[model samples]
Target: MEWGPTGAAAVPADYAVVVDVLSFTTTLSVALERGIEVFPFRWRDARAAEHAMRHGATLAVGRFEAMSRGDARHVSLSPASLSEVEGIQRLVLPSPNGSTIAFALADSGAQVVGACLRNAGAVARWLAPRVADGASVVVVPAGERWHDDTLRPAVEDLWGAGAVLDALLDALGGEDEVTSPEARMAVAAWRAARLPDDLLRCAGGVELTDVGFVADVEIAAQHDVSEVVPVLVGESFRDATEVQPAAPKLRRVDG
Candidate 1:
């Protein structure tokens, strides 16, 4: 699951590792760190407001809209701004890539966890109990979209996924227990790349920088800085530390 919405149709795995390094997942990690619950939405449509209202959460108006308002009171998808927000209990994070993938995975009955470079190690540690129980995992690098809405493989996302996979392998004591080919490739790619500095010069990173989102890139590139793992429970993502385990070795089957 390295592109588009393919993870929705990917082979059923016990857990889903959704990575969107540009912002979504990174923002998720930050917000969850601050005790905010995130609801992944596919669109910022009228339904977003309804969903937010239902959850007593704030609907993100996006970075551009929030910037134009000249107010720091609103929460958007920006990781920096999200880190600054305080006292918010819940949020609606809508994205074409990460959120969409997460929504699909949740609908398909998978135990979904949001991951990024910032919280890769923590996420892997949180997921260790499940993985060690012989449960498989799908590492989805939710790539950016092209002009035609096709999946454009973003190097940042690949690195994010690789970081998480690598962390998982390390936790599992090596790749002997990991049989997924995609997982292995992700680990290999992350090991061969230049990391934070290289991530800044990647295509997605450059585009974000051009749009005055350099801070977001820097925030996303902070490796292993967070201990929060955003695990999707019901319709919202809450810090895994705050949530109790559903069942011991309870592996979910494909719906």
Candidate 2:
């Protein structure tokens, strides 16, 4: 919306969909699918460890640090690392972009949901009826950061946000009234862009691949393939797709 979590908070919506397809939310999507509860953190500090300990959960390590230490068994943030892990009931994932927005929205009076290309359709389908029933929704693209720790508007996130928005707009059927210009532009970007190939060439994708985490990008690139919709429940994200009433599925716009 405006800029940071502050701008996002300014907007009044029934739901805020936070997307970080590069890693955070993608791993979240995968973890939820595997039935693991996720707690999002903004910083990788001692607080994360303490929170994890307090919850009796496992603290996630940075992807680079995990790889450096050859720690594949308990890898915290990688979708590829999920296969190597076992018995992980809860996870505290630290991400500067997506996690910060999601955690900040915990008390924003609106429901918070984690999104990526993977679960955009499911999230859209879940929101469509509520929206038709007069519930508002806002899609937040958690852009990447710059070297100086500034926000870098990552296209991968735009695509991820757009993926959710495009489907939402399609499901609502009244794009003129139910959508904003920015939402229309996001849908345009999603429609015009070659998502799968462009994601592999995008900055976020290349960054992951450059560090040997190409699998993360590949996982993030999958479009609407996942059905797990992770909603922020209290301090952590839990899958909500199970308890939701069956609604009309989004008509997938395949290219």
Candidate 3:
């Protein structure tokens, strides 16, 4: 399912996968790689400094729309400082769109994994065993809602999610087969034929380049950099490298 910033409501599912391809999700992945613990906050209700004070969590805010708000005590995930907080706890996060969606799916029954173009390949390998067991996988792309009708970058998440779906299919040895309607659409949108270029042209990719995080963008665009798959454990996420089969496929009606 694709959810916008304001639509951070919890949904029922076996697993909720969040993707904020452009920077937020990519930032989260980078932070975790650096050893920083990332805590998600709802965009509408998120007051980073206040929340940090209340929960004693460190604040890590991103600069967006050319504005920098909140306390200076927090760390900013600008392209320049992406590698600084490798192993710290990032209490409050205000990302362009990805962070909020991660929070929205926090309560989803299935495990939550932060996704970006960078980790798509690793994520697919991580989920290969699960899909083989018939687990219901829901890929949630934390997309944008553009006010201007002329250009909307939110659809980039859809393309990112499609790339993930394609990766999963390939892992399952069904690269040439359409597993479902959503899979087919994602494949079509990405033109799954020329995946690498398609991924580079995504909205998130453009934003990363503008911010001079093109290297970071390229890193996130890689299939699987680490075998470590980040999964939410209690309040924070830990690296999960083992892939377990799903409990059992549940038959449900999607009306």
Candidate 4:
């Protein structure tokens, strides 16, 4: 288990579980469940609009920004906001944490899997077979950014990463696979977490709720409620399980 891009760069495993619980990965899971192919982009990238237009995909903005726009168009980093979105075949979802790490990992030849509290178990289930076959895996907790553009190490992401690690360990129980101390620490954090209640009080959760996105916080706390395992394929994330048995498996900003 590691935090942010720097840590991610230091550990390039065969499989990477990208976690950004308050947004990104969680939102990706929700969109995947709706059949919307998601393209991860850098947060606040001015080129995102151009990329979206070029590919005829919707570009997501911040939750508060979208809400203040007073338009009916739905979609944002907030998972709950996408609940009512429809007819969007594709989306250009941007984020500084999860999306950045995902694209970086993809370029490094690592199989990228988007994981959040919502779909941790599903991701673990998807990874079990491959891991048992001796594949390496790393759970990356994409921490929040500070005002100075530094890593904030949000507890929300830690919990999300922990959730995935714990599930993976459970799925691989009794295996003598070498698990790192950091991975063990994350699993311990998950074991000690108090669920929705604790999540609600965490810094990340408070930040979202204070901005009137309490629903998003509540949605993120719904652990393992999703079965969609988002696998980054080509320039988008699609459900590998939904792919035909014969088809190739499962992200640049390009279409």
Identify the leading candidate in terms of TM-score.
1
Candidates sorted by TM-score, descending order? 1, 4, 2, 3
lDDT of 4 by residue, 232-254 (tens): 88778899787532222221112
TM-score of each: 0.93, 0.91, 0.73, 0.92
Flag the better candidate by lDDT, 2 or 4: 4
Clashing residue pairs in candidate 4, if any?
none
Candidate 1 clash pair list: none
> Which candidate number would show the highest lDDT if scored against the true structure?
4
lDDT of 3 by residue, 1-255 (tens): 445533334334555567776656666667667666667665524476676667676776555422244333446555235555444455566654666666555554457777766677777787888767656567777766566622244656666677677788889897543255765676576544344554566665676678665665565555455454567655555556433433433434353
With a 3 Å backbone cut-off (N, CA, C), the pairs that clash in candidate 2 are: none
> Residue 1 deviation, candidate 3, in Å?
4.9
State each model's CA lDDT, in order.
0.84, 0.81, 0.60, 0.85
Better of 2 and 4 by TM-score: 4
User: lDDT tens string, model 2, 1-255?
Assistant: 333465577775777788888778899999888888999998889999999999988888877778788755557588878746778889899888889999898877778888899999998998788777767777888887778987778887777888888888788774765467777787788887786789889887887789788888888889988998898877889899554522322323223
Q: What's model 4's lDDT at 10?
A: 86
Q: What's the ranking of the predictions by lDDT, best on top?
A: 4, 1, 2, 3
| TM-score of decoy 3 | 0.73
User: TM-score for model 4?
Assistant: 0.92
Shift in Å, residue 193, candidate 3? 8.0
